[model samples]
Target: MKTQQRVGAGPGRGLAAALGATVCAAVFTAAALPGTAWAAGESPYGFDGGAQPIKGAATSLDARPLTAGQSYRDSIKKDGKLYYRVDLGTQENAYVSVVAVPKAGGAAEYGDGITVTLQDGSGAQCGYQDSSFASATFTRPITAYAHRTIEPDRSTCQQAGAYYVLVERTSKAASPPDDWQLEIRYVPEPGVTQNGPTELPENWPSSSPPPPVGGPQKRQGGTGFHDATSLRQGEWRADIEPGQTLFYRVPVDWGQQVFATAELGSSPTGATGYVPNALVLSLDNPARGHVDQNTVSYDGKPATLALDPHRPVAFENRYSSHSTTNALRFAGWYHLSATLSPEIVKEYGDRPVQLTLRVNVTGTPKAGPAYAGDAGPFQVTADDRDAAASGASGDEAGTNDGMVVVAAAGIGAGTVLLAGLGVWSFAGRRRAARDAARGGPGGPQDGPSPFGPPPPAW
Candidate 1:
C-alpha cells in the first residue's frame, strides 16, 4: 500500500492524510476564548454546553472544538453532514468516545459514525484478526479509545508516526446551527508502561506475531471489560410473605462456574412466587457466587428457563412488583454450566483471581433452597410433569445438542434486522443478538444481512 502522503492537509489544501482519509488535522492550539466552560442555558444552544455549534460535511476539515460536557449535549439540528476527527496523537493509551445527534426518531436512523481504517507506513491495508477492541458495542457508543489491545493485522504503517483518525455522522437532516451538538473525547489507557504521547503507528515490526492478549488470567475474580456480554438467570419474584418457600437448582459436575453467579430475590409490591430463603453472595463468601444448601429447587419437579438475547431479556423493560427494582441495580447471579476441553480446564480451572461476581438483592430478607455444585452435571428430572418439564421431550443428551443452532434459527426475523453488520458474524452468537436489534424494519425476511451470507437451512 502507498505509505507516505503529504502531511498537514486541510480543506482545499491538497494535503493527503494517511489511510486515504480526506479530512486531516494538526496539533490543537490552546485558545484564550471566554467562558468555553459555561453552565446551563449559557452554552451555544443555551443548554450549558461549552462549544458553539459549527456545522459542515464529514468530508470537510473546518471541524470545531467539542464543547465541555462532550459526553452530554443540547438537542440541535443540522441540514449538512457533521464532520469530526479523533486524535490520540503520541498519547500512549488514550481512549476515545463519540455521540451523534439527529432530528427524527420515527424510522430508525444512523446518528454518529467514525471512519475507521488501520494501516502501516506508506498506507498499506493491515489484515486484522482476534480484535478485542474491533467490536461494535451497543448499550454504548464506539469505545475503541478505551481498548489497549489491537488484533493481529499485517499493516504497512507499523512504526510510531502520523495515523489518520476520521469519524462521520449518518442521520436525518437536522435544524441547522440550532440545538445541535456531537460529543467526542480522549481518555488515557491503564497498565501502560509509559504515557508517551503517540498516534496510530506508521509502522510496526513486520516479524512480530500479533500482540498476545495478556498473561496468567486471574480465576474467580471480576470479569474484565473484555468479557463482552453475559447471559445469566437473574432472580425469582414475589414478596417475602410468611412461610414463603423459594427454590433454585443448577448443574453440578459441570464443575462450578467461578466467575458466574446465581441469585434469587423478592419485591414487596406484588406477592408472586414465594421462596423461603435468600442472601447476598460476595468474594467474601465461601460459595462465592454459587448457592449454599437446602435452597436448590429440583428433585423430580425442576424448573426450565431461557435467556433470550433478543427480546431485550426478561424484566429488561418492566420491573416485577416483587423485584428489588428500586433497591438494587437489578443485577442477578448466573446459573451457568460451561463446556471446556481438558486443555481449557487445565489452563483456567485453578488460575488465581479468576472472574468473580458479587450477588445481592434489596428487599425484605428470608432464607432456604441454596444448592452449590462441587462436581457433576446437574440433573433436574421431573416425573409426572412429563420429561418435557425439564425442557427435554426425549433424551436429555439429544436435547442439549446444537444449542447455538436452535437459539439462532428460532429467533424472529425482526430481531435479526436490528443488529449491526460486524455483530451478525457467527450464525450462532451474532445471529441471536441481531434478531434482538430488529425493530420496525422490513419483514422477518428482510433477506440476508448486508454483511454476511444467507442464513442456513433449517
Candidate 2:
C-alpha cells in the first residue's frame, strides 16, 4: 500500500502563499505613487486630474449646478448648446470660463469656435464672450468666458439668485463632427469694502515698451491654467511641436503693467511652405478671461507674435470700454498661452520648433482693494510672488522638481521589487511542485528543476 501523504500542507506551499501576498503588496505600493509622474507627457489640453466629470443639460431646465472654485469636465457636440446653473450671492462677482478642445488633427474652419454667456434666470444677458479658431489652419483648444458682476449702478443680473451659463459651439459643415472636450471653471470674487474709481483711466501708456534684455532662461511650459509655469520679468526659452500649446503665468500685481512677446524659431528640417496663423499667442486675466491675442503666419522661417501694450492692473480698468483694458481689473497671475498650428506638421516636419518668450512686468506694486471676505484664487499671495520670482510651475510651485525626482525613484524601486517578486514566486511554485511530487521535505531531488534554482531562503 502507498504511504499516506497530506496534500497542500507543506512548507513549500506555505512559502508560495506568502510570495503571492508579497507580489500583491508590491503592486499596491506601485499603484500608490503620485500621479504627476505620468503628467509630464500628457497633452496640453488634457483636463485636470482632479476635475469632476459632469454632463451638461441640453436645456436650462435640467442644467447641472456648478459650485464656485471648482472645475468640471464635459463635452459639447458641434453646434450644440449646453446649460449649467450657478447660485450666487449679491455680494460676490462670478466669472465662468469654458475651454473647448477639438480633436487632434480634426478639420476646423476659421470661424469654428465657442461662445459663452452669463444670463439671469429671466433670460437677461449679463456678460458674453466668444473665441474662434480665427486664421488657424488646424484645430486647437480655444477659451471664452462670461461673468455676472454686482455693480453699484448696474441693473441686470444683480440679484442674489440663480444664474445660467450658456455654452454654444459654432461649427461649419466642414468641421469635425466629433464632440469637443470642455473644461469649465467657476471663480467668485468677494465684494470690496471700499470701491475704486468707476471711470476708466484717461492717461495710461499705450505704446509697447522694449522687450526685456537678458539671456533666455530654460523653462518648461505647463499644459493649462492650473499648471501654467510661473515666470517673472525675463526671457524664457522652451520648445514647441506642431499642434502643441504651452501655458505660462506671470504675477501682475496692482499698478504693474505686463507685456509679452513670443518668438518661434525657423523649422529644423528647413521644410518650406507658408501656413497662415501658424503661431498664436494669447493673454488671459486672472479669471481666465481673454485679454488680447496675436497671430502670425509661418514658412520655415522665424516668426514673432507680440501682444498689444496692456494697461497696468487697476480696479478702475474694469470700467473701460476696451476689452483688453477691462480685463485688467485685478492683480493676480496673468496667463500666457502659445499655440503652434498642426498645419506646420505638414509644411514643416514634426520636429519641435524652438520658442522664446520675452516677458516684462513694470511699475511698482500697489495695494489691492479690501475685500469683505477672502479674495479667493484671484488674489496674488506672497507665496505666489515667490514662486513666480523663482520660475516654478503653478501646481507644484517650488517643489515640482523635487517631487518629480522622488516619484521617479519610487517608480524605479517599485518596478524592481515587483519584477524580483514575480521571479521568486514562479521559482518557488516550481520547487514546491517538484518537492511534493517527490513525497515531502526530504524527498529525492530529480536533477535540476526546469523553472530555475530553488528560491533563496526568505
Candidate 3:
C-alpha cells in the first residue's frame, strides 16, 4: 500500500498551524481572565460571584437546605415569602443575612424593604430583623439578618436540630412589582471552649472617640461583602456614584472598639433640593449581622453619618440587651457599607461624589475565645490584622480560590502557547528540508504529514 502523501506541506501550512495554536492560546487566556471583579462605582449591587444559585421554597416543608459558611443567590417576588433550612449544633451560633436588591430606576416607598426571621423546627422564632428603605426615595439593596445564638438563658429555639430561615419582602403599594434579587449568606460560629465574662460591662465608654487623625488615603471600595476592601484605623477616601453601595471590612480584635464615620463631600453641582437619607452608613458584624447604621440627609452639602459608640468586643456582649452590643461578641472583620441614594442623581447630575471613611479602632488587641471547633472566617487572624494595617483589599489580603484558579489557568495557557510555537518551528524546518530534497519550491512532496490535515482557510 502506498503511503498517503502529505497534502499542502509548505510554508502556508506551517503558518496556518501556528496561527491556529495562537488563536487557541489566546481564547484560553481570555477565558481564564478575572471576570467577577466589579467596578468600584457601579450603580447596581454586585452579588457574590462565587455564591451558589439556590431556589428558595415557598414554605418550610419544602425549603432547601443551606450549609454554613456558604453564600447563596436567590430571588423574591413582590410580597413574597421564602424559606430555607439550616442544621445547627447545640453549641453553635448560626447567622443568616439576606440582601434584597430592588429594581434599578424603580419606585420605592419609605417602608419598602425586607424582613428576615430565624425559627426553630417548631416554628418558634429565635431572631427577627427588619430593614427598610426608610427616607430614601430611590431603590437600592437593603440587608437584614437573623441569628440563633446558643445562650444558656434562652428558653426556646436553642436545640441541635434543623432551623428555618424566613425571608419576606415588605413593600407598599407604591413600590415596584418587580422581583428583587437576593444574596443569602450563612455563617456559623463555634462555641468557645473557655468561659468568659457572662455579664455586660458595667462601665464602658459611651462617647464616640475622635475620628482618625491622618491624611485621607485613596482606596477604592468593593461592591460586595466577599470583596470588601480591608480598612484599618485611618481615613480612607473613595468616589461613589448615585445609587451605588461600597463595602469595606475592618478587622476588630477582641477588646477593641470600632468607631466609624462616613462623610459625603460637598456636591460640585451646588444643587439645592434636600434629599432625606441621601447617604447611609452601616456596620455589620463578622456574621453579616446588623450592628448599627446611620443615615444623613443631603442638600449638595457635606453630610456625615457616625455610628454610636458601643461596648468593646467581648464574649459577654452577646448577653447584653442591645442588639448592637450583642453583635460585638466576636473578633473578626466587621463590614461597613456606604450607600448613596439614587435620588441624588436627579439633582446632582449623576456625578460621582467623594466618600470619606474615618475609622478608629481603639483598645489593645487581646486574646480571643478558644473554640471547640474551627471558628473559620468568623475570627480575625494575625494575617487579617496585618492585611488591614497594610491597606490591602480583600482580594489581595485573603486567599481567593477563584483568583487562584484563574492564575493557574493563565500560566497553563502560556505554556501551551510556547509549546505550540516550538512545534510550528520544527514543522517548518522539516517542510523546508523536504522541499529542498525535491529540488525547489515547485517540487513533489511525499509521506504523510506529522501535523494533521491543514486547518481550513482563515
Considering every candidate listed, which one attains the maximal lDDT?
2
In candidate 2, clashing pairs total 0
Cα lDDT computed for each candidate against the true fold: 0.22, 0.72, 0.71
Off by over 4 Å in 3: 1-43, 153-155, 403-458
What are the runs in model 2 whose C-alpha is more than 4 Å off?
Answer: 1-44, 398-458
Give each model's clash number: 74, 0, 0
Instruction: Give per-model TM-scores.
Output: 0.25, 0.78, 0.78
Superposition-based RMSD of candidate 2 using all C-alpha atoms, in angstroms: 19.6
Candidate 3 clashing pairs, residues 3+ apart or interchain: none
> lDDT per residue, candidate 3, 1-458, as tens digits?
00010000099788767756754554444333332323432225656645678999988989999977667888899899999999888888888888887665456877778888999899888887777766665676667788887776666877888899999997788777888888898888787676767887589878887766657777667767766777777777788888788888988877788999999898676677888888888888887767788888988788888888888888778776666777787878999988888778778887789998998788766666777887677566767765665555564455443433334455456445554454445434544553344233221111221112212211
Clashing pairs in 2: none
Candidate 3's error at 137, in angstroms?
3.7
Q: Report the C-alpha lDDT of model 2 over 255-329, residue by residue, as the tens digit.
A: 788889999888777677998888889888888888888888988888898887878888777666676777788
Q: Which candidate number maximizes TM-score?
A: 3
Q: Which structure is stronger by TM-score: 1 or 2?
A: 2
> Which one wins by lDDT: 1 or 3?
3
